[model samples]
Target chain A: MKAIVPIKRVVDPYAKVKPTADGAGLDSGGAKFEINPFDEIAVEEAVRQKEAGRFTEVVVVSVGKGECEEQLRKALAIGADRAVLLETQEPLDSPAVAKVLSEFVAAEAPHVVLMGKQATDDDNNQAGQMLAAILDWPQATFAAKTDFAADKATVVRETDSGEETLELPYPCLVTTDLRLNEPRYIALPGIIKARSKPLEKRPLASVPAPKSSVVSFAPAPARPPGRKVGSVAELAQAIKDRGVF
Target chain B: MSLLVICFDPSELSQVAGFGASFGTYDVLLLTGEAGNAGASKIHVANLVEVPPADNIGKSVASVAANYTHVAAVSSMRAKDLMARVAGINQSAMITDVVKVFSETEFERPMVAGSVLARVKAESTPIVMTFRPAGFDKTVPGPNGSVESISISDTGRVKRVSTSARQGGRPDLSQAKFVVSGGRPLKDAATFEQVIGGFADKFGAAVGATRAAVDSGIAPNDLQVGQTGKVVAPDLYIAAGISGSTQHMAGIKDSKLIVAINKDGDAPIFDQADLGIVGDLYEVLPELEKALS
Candidate 1:
């Protein structure tokens, strides 16, 4: 069996980024970049599955410009067997990205596809579900815990109200959540070994037109400055003044 | 344009209806309970099991996709997941967590965790999206609308084994008008609950916690309020002990009024708060609770 994990290159989650001066998109110049935090969890889970001998090969794939290969290599250092970069200069929406991934998955035919629930960049939270729909496969998203068996997987999902458990047969998709697993640190030896791993780059065979496009960007409006109160009684008075019980 | 609002949680009904009103007269697909107050021209009821998996719900919604020019739902994890499938099935444009609807085709949504807001345009028909409930007001209830029963078969491959929903009558974190959130300083679950939950219970406010608190196991996963957790925009939000990480602030930036109480006078939360109290929560919260009583 083989597991496919798709990763993305996004601005570091901890770094504070802003929109470009022209209101076009993110001003990522000189900004720190990393594998999207959630996708990192997905990569870690797939590598663990491979280590456990459930899958012989774990491949990490990404769709973006050539710079994306850097993130793909980092995934290799973390234990993925190989990497594939679907090179594209065109901006792709969640639906278009799903279309690209579906075409690749058809030829790869992995038993299971693991993905991050959403990227910290766009935060669309759509690709995995859209891919599952396009592939006509079962999906268990926001999975906090997943147990793999011969033919099916039991997953505990983090929902708004609480947690839910779902079972899906093979050839299914599972999107990782925050509590899934902590990614292992890439050490010197792992980084050195990653250099020898095969990093394949292929031009996107077909890039579907984006259904939705960003028109402009603006910095979020700031909240009015607040005043500090002296004590609890003063705070209570303010709350009462606002009509809050 | 015919808009079809997907109604699930009753608390978010008016918000969704109010948003749909911007697009003109709309109908509803009632998934769970009554939406008599939705103020829609028509309510299409779907016969299904309780809390059906989003995969099944998405398939059901897509089956009737041809009837409306647009489909929308209140933004939530489940609704976003379901709408993605519907978008895929119909090849429609999909947008999530829309904070502003400029028109039927244009919208503004936050990116990079609310630091930047991007205006987007849907270039195609049958647009599928979810609007943030906090960004809009609840629409007033109108005369009862006609109801039509619709058959939606379960065509999903996933099966639900069990669900352990959070207990108690606390209002939902997203819909609550008043919220009290705690931070990591609370230590353990018992202490966190006694302090934060106790304060919230005093005035029937919903309880929330920063990601730091949740990661430390002092709070349940559902109570997390941050970029990756639940986004809340209550009328009044009280923060005790939280330093207000950027992600945490992103979740609460929409809140109408914010009050922060932290011993660290330099905590970032105070910068965004409408009222700041520099003091120890241990001493201040108890006194504030007493004052509220």
Candidate 2:
């Protein structure tokens, strides 16, 4: 069996991001980049499954510009046996991205695909579901836990109501949620070894144009500054003043 | 032009109605297992399709795609997940967690964990989107509109095995007008329930917790409030023991009134709260509870 993981490079979650002065995009200058946290978890899960002798290989795939190769290498260091970069400079919407991935999945025929539920950059949360739709495959999204058997996988999903478990046949897709796993940190030796791992690069294949575009971005409106009351009594009075008591 | 609003929970009909109102005049496609009135020109699909456990509701909606110029649902996880796939199958454009609906093709939504807002235009037909429940007021129930029933074959392949729902009598965090949330400082589950849960019950509020608290097992995952969890815009939001991570702040930024109670005065939540009390919650909570009683 083979497990494929799709990873994305996003602005570091810890760093502050601002809208570009032109309001067309983010002011990414000087911002640090990292493998999207959830995708890191995906790579970790795939690696764990491989370590358990459940798979022969764990392949990490990324779609982006040259910088994305850096993230692919990082995924290798984290435990993926190989990495593939769909090098592209074009801005691809979620559907376009899904189209590219679905094509790749069809050719690769991996037994299972694991990816982050959403990328922090766009927060679209569409790619996994879109890929499932395109591939006509079962998908267990927002997956917190996955119990695998020989022919089926049971995924515990984190839903709005609570946890819902779904059983799907093999050759399925699962999107990682926050609680899935804590990604292991890459050590110096792992980083050094990652440089020697197989990293394949291929140009992005042509796909349909994206139908949606970002027209403008604006800073979120500021919240009114808070006032510190001396005691609980004052806090109660404030709540009462707001007619909320 | 008509609008199709996929119904998940019956209570979500009002949010769908608010979304449909923006289209001037539209029809609602209510999809559910049971039938009910939704105060709109409606088509009820009781078991329109046999939904496989692993299949999304979007597949069924997309299969029946018809004359509607817009398709919408409340921005819950299930709805957003389904609508996104529907958009993919239709090769249409979709925007999620929309806060403003200017037209069938234009909308505004938050990004960067709600720190930035983007106004987007979908230059495609049959726009599919999900509206943030907090962004619009629930429409008042009107005279019953016409309801028609239709059925379709189920193509779902996934099977649901089990569900472990969080047991509670409190109001849903998303629908509640008042909320009381806890953070890491709450310590353990017993204290979380006794303190935060106690306060929520006292004020007739919903219970919420920061991701930190939920991750630590002090609260159930469903009670989490943040960019990754549930976004709430209640009338009153009280943050106790929470330090207010940016993602956590993203969920409550829209609350009409915010109160923070924490021992450390420098917690970021204090800056966002309308009123803040810098003291031990162990002391403050009981005092406030007594005062309210």
Candidate 2 has which clashing residue pairs, if any?
B53-B158, B54-B158
TM-scores of all predicted structures: 0.97, 0.96
Q: What is the per-residue lDDT of model 2 for residues B1-293, given as tens digits with 9 covering 90 to 100?
A: 67777776456666665656777655566555654555677656554432344364556678665457777778778876677778777877778788988766778999888888998898787778888866765676464467777664455577787877776688988888989999988889999999888878887889999999988889988999988899998888889898988889989998999988989989888888889999999899889888777
Q: What is the TM-score of chain A alone in each candidate?
A: 0.96, 0.97
lDDT per residue (tens digit) for residues B1-293 in model 1:
88998877555556766687688788888776655677888878774557578776666679787688899888888887788888888888998888888998999898888888999999898899888867765667574378888776676678999999885889999889999999999989999989999889888999999988887789998999978899998989999999999899989998888999999999998889999899999999999888988
Residue by residue across A1-245, what tens digits does model 2's lDDT show?
89889999999886777798999888766878999888998999999888888878999998879899888989999889999998888988888889899888899999899999998877778889889888988888998998767899889999887889898898999999989988998987888889999999998766567778888999899897979999888878778888976
Supply the TM-score for candidate 1: 0.97
As for candidate 1, its clashing pairs are none
TM-score for chain B in model 2: 0.92
* Alpha carbon lDDT at B276, candidate 2: 93
Cα-based lDDT at residue B263, candidate 2:
90
Go through the candidates in order and give each one's DockQ. Answer: 0.84, 0.81
Where is model 1 more than 4 Å wrong at Cα? none
